[model samples]
Target: MEKNYFNLLQLPVVLPIDGSLLSLHYQQLQRQFHPDNYATAPDNEKAAILQQSASINAAYQTLKDPIKAAEYRLSLEGININEEQQTIHDSPFLMEQFMLREQLDDLEHAQNWDELTLFYDEMIERKNQIYAQLLEYINQSHWLMAKQQLYKLRYYAKLIEQIELLQEKQFNL
Candidate 1:
């Protein structure tokens, strides 16, 4: 049986519009539906609990992350995004992704920690700006604009991963 997002989210249909509050609701659902809690239950009950837990986890993971949430919302609108089968029509976003990929490649080969730090700082600033725009777009019901912002968010998320790797290298050396 497919679970409704509202049920998986463990939230009322008319949940608060606050993102932070939604995150808290996701945590609450995690506590309630986590598979560990069903370890001692009957076999049939455990099976049902595990299935529900997986659905809850999938829902929370998508909803708590801005990019995933936007993508999920788009899917609901029948805007499918299969990276292999579907092409993103946003040329500017594609260009930005290419630029970011080049910068990440350059950073990977750079010997100077200062350069990496500078790049990390720039990406963080961009992320914050995008996040602010995301909040505004969401409030204004600009779904397309919010989806565009989410594309930027994905770039920042990858940049964060790169920064973490660089930090680890610095700590080890």
Candidate 2:
């Protein structure tokens, strides 16, 4: 299963890249090895099909998400960025996130739409900067660094969600 993930990551990791190619590949592979396809076969063959199907699903999931795709690549290089194993190497990013959260809390209490707009824009810019860093890490094959960038990207995405909620409140009022 792990080997299959490595193979899938080797393919382009974009959602729209070569449309229908991945789906076609997955379908062909599944048809040949899906557990149901081996229902009439021996027990050993059925077991093998189950194992292969599991691998296929795992590969499909990893290739579907850019962040996961990056992590899988890192894993191939002996780097594991699982949540429990991840280190906090980016203190500045953490500190910034803390400050942003504080400001968001204050804005929520004050109902300051204008300040929220400015903060949202700043956070969006920060997200773009992090994406640029992520690209650099990918280009350099710095999987660990890219994993850190992924953390920052997730944080920014969450912040965007919060900003959207604030905007909705503003619109409602």
Candidate 3:
């Protein structure tokens, strides 16, 4: 059986998890599973410890990130969100995405600090709103709606990454 990340991390398997608490739990697990402590053990024991350590690390990584946590949660409910096969049929969202991308392209050329900051803020707001809806849908057991929100959230995340890269370039140059 696939390991339940929430259970492994001692989390409640809920959205909007406490990041600091998660980090605390992760640190405790790391200390418990650190390989150096088992160096004097037999080879088979060492191998098993290593596997347990790896599983702990994987669970931490997955549960630490909101998107990954949501994906894992959905998978647990048997709703596999296949990015390649799943199509977001919301036309308005698609149109908004195109417009946002167009704006981003123009911002790339213009390199206006104020505009870039505004766009970044806008993306953040959109991401927050989507996350709110995602939480609502998930709470209500609206799996499909939550899945669609997750897809939209991914796009906003990419936009945020691009904006941050642009900001980094500006800072360096």
> How much lDDT does candidate 3 score?
0.90
TM-score of each: 0.67, 0.71, 0.95
CA lDDT of each prediction against the hidden true structure: 0.71, 0.75, 0.90
Instruction: Report the C-alpha displacement of residue 162, candidate 3, in angstroms.
Output: 0.9
Clashing pairs in 2: none
Better of 1 and 3 by lDDT: 3
- Identify the runs in model 3 with alpha carbons over 4 angstroms from their true place: none
lDDT of each residue in 1-75, candidate 3, tens digit only:
866888888889788789998999999999998999999999999998899899999988888889988888888
Give the Å error, residue 48, model 3: 1.2
Better of 2 and 3 by TM-score: 3
Residues 85-113 of candidate 2: C-alpha lDDT, one tens digit per residue: 65567888789889889999999889999
List ranges where model 2 is wrong by over 4 Å. 6-20, 83-85, 110-125, 161-173
- Candidate closest to the true structure, highest TM-score: 3
Residue-wise lDDT of candidate 1 within 1-173, one digit each (tens)? 66656556655433223577677877887788777988899999989888877777788777766567666765655555444544446788778778877877777677567787888888888888887887677667776776667666776887788787977888788
